[model samples]
Target: MAFFAALHARMTGRKVGQDRFGNTYYESRKMMPVYNRYRRFVVTANGQDPTKVPAEWHCWLHHLTDAPLPEDKRLPWQKEHVPNLTGTRYAYRPKGHLAMGGQRQASGSDYEAWTP
Candidate 1:
């Protein structure tokens, strides 16, 4: 319930900035008091992938922008940040695959024949 209340506040907050992945950031001159201790006017996102953050909002979050988002800071060679992949299947697999190349022995049942 508290989380939902805080989310409501964030949705109605003074729209500060939005990220590339539709994540939005909000700020208040005076922190809006919350009934729940964990809920407050704090920065948050759906998840932590830096790439999810829009360029402008990311800049602001990282102290690069003073007025929401700046255009001059955009530059080439800036690799987009990707989320940490630790346990996902898409994660890197060294050299050994599940099917390592050990041939299975034929079943004894294969030699059995039907007598006409």
Candidate 2:
């Protein structure tokens, strides 16, 4: 958090809750005239990586719900949140991708070009 942002959060923002990603959420101590509600914000733990926010926290961040959906009451079928991995070493690369050694095992169904 920037010096001014940290000061602002401390001066007027009331701490709400924190999500699993270590991001902390807050609302203004008083209602704002524009929205007729207290302002809300989040201090992300991973710098500017918004993808680190889970679905439930995303809801609260966007004012989609009065509060974040319960974390423990998750349905059995629900999967845990995973941040976007694009541009990182953990990102998916096809078997033949140049970064993956540019080699892929040839199968019987593989396409072949004409020799002509």
Candidate 3:
């Protein structure tokens, strides 16, 4: 993968600007051969979930950043990237989750519909 990346970059004469969360970005004074051609590919442990990537990486991927984020300059408002794993076991378990206990608390009252 790295070899192909290097080849493409070299052939295109793109300058590698930054890398974060295993993704790399490149730019060239010349336009890319393909439209919407992103210079970076995010590498993930399990793959999928763009959310798994950090905020900095997301910015680069979306062309929001002209330059990569610096380690010391991360903004206070930026939250750490967390993947949404809904329906999966790794998803966050709330205190009152049904999986933890067989108990089902009453919301107000159980209503039964009447039919003719």
Candidate 4:
């Protein structure tokens, strides 16, 4: 399925810059009659998860910017994008999180009960 998508993209779409994750971006060479605008899309290097796309590329994919990253350029202060870790082993676990196998510490003197 991805193979055909890639082929179609290559045949009718212009290549945009690829992100660090290897996801390739593209824009239709010609406008579609249905939308009356060039269609934009991304081929994920691995999974179909959209979070894999970086913020800079996200803008281009959504047509937020007329210029793609290849032409627009990223700022130096920008950090590399990381996919969301939810549902994975690397997901954040607070001190008392059940997955962390730790119980919540008892409230101490600093704790105050709410009064009506």
Candidate 5:
């Protein structure tokens, strides 16, 4: 299924730019009938995770910005983007999380319980 999607995107879309992560961004060569506008999309270099897209590229992909990151002027204080790590080994696990393999730390007196 991904193969077909890639093929269709390649045939119908024009190359925009690639991010440091290797994800390639594309836009429809012609306006799409359904949306009545040109469609924009990205092909992830690693997996099917949408969060893999960086902030700059994401803006272009969602039509939030008219110019790609390369043409846009970035602020000096801007930092590089990072993808979510929910399912990976680097995913965050609180002290109480089951995967952490330890008993949950007690909630102090300030903790309040919610009632229906």
Candidate 6:
């Protein structure tokens, strides 16, 4: 996030909550001029990385829910949340991926060119 944005949020936005990842949520204290509804946002602990925002917080940030779901309210079937790792070392690399040695087993349906 930019320094000016952080300053604006801190000055005008009402702090909603902070997530486990250290992100702080906020909303405009008064109704916005054109939209009427208050504006919502997050002051990210890390830089502005959208993937770092978790599911529950994402929901609230988008105004899907009036408030964020309590972190402890998760059900037993839910697995532990992991942030997006697309650019990191632990990112998924399938058999055909260049990082995975660029080799893939030929499939039964492999297309062949017609020699008329």
Query: Roughly what TM-score does model 5 have, to 2 decimal places?
Result: 0.73
Error of 2 at 71 (Å): 0.7
- Error in Å for residue 25 of model 6: 0.5
Best by TM-score: 6
TM-score for each model:
0.44, 0.73, 0.52, 0.73, 0.73, 0.85
Instruction: Give the per-residue lDDT of model 6 (tens digit) for 1-116.
Output: 46777899999998899999988899999997898788999877878888888898999888899989889888989987787899999999998999999999999899999998
Candidate 3 residue-wise lDDT, 1-116, digit = tens: 65665667556655554444554445644655686454544444344456676666667667787665664576789775667878889987766688877566667677879999
Candidate 1 residue pairs that clash:
19-54, 20-54
lDDT of 1 by residue, 20-59 (tens): 5455566544543662212113234554344455555555
Cα lDDT for residue 19, candidate 6: 91
Q: Judge candidate 5 against the unseen true structure and give its global Cα lDDT, from 0 to 1.
A: 0.82
Model 1 segments beyond 4 Å from truth?
Answer: 1-6, 31-51, 54-59, 62-65, 71-73, 93-116
- State the C-alpha lDDT per candidate: 0.53, 0.85, 0.61, 0.83, 0.82, 0.88
Error of 6 at 99 (Å): 1.2
Instruction: Mark the regions of model 4 whose C-alpha exceeds 4 Å error after superposition.
Output: 70-77, 105-116
Tell me model 1's lDDT, rounded to 2 decimals. Answer: 0.53
Q: What ranking of all candidate models by lDDT puts the best one first? A: 6, 2, 4, 5, 3, 1
Count of clashing residue pairs in every prediction: 2, 0, 0, 0, 0, 0
Q: What TM-score would candidate 6 get against the native?
A: 0.85
Worst 10 residues of 4 by lDDT: 66-75
Query: How many residue-pair clashes does candidate 1 contain?
Result: 2
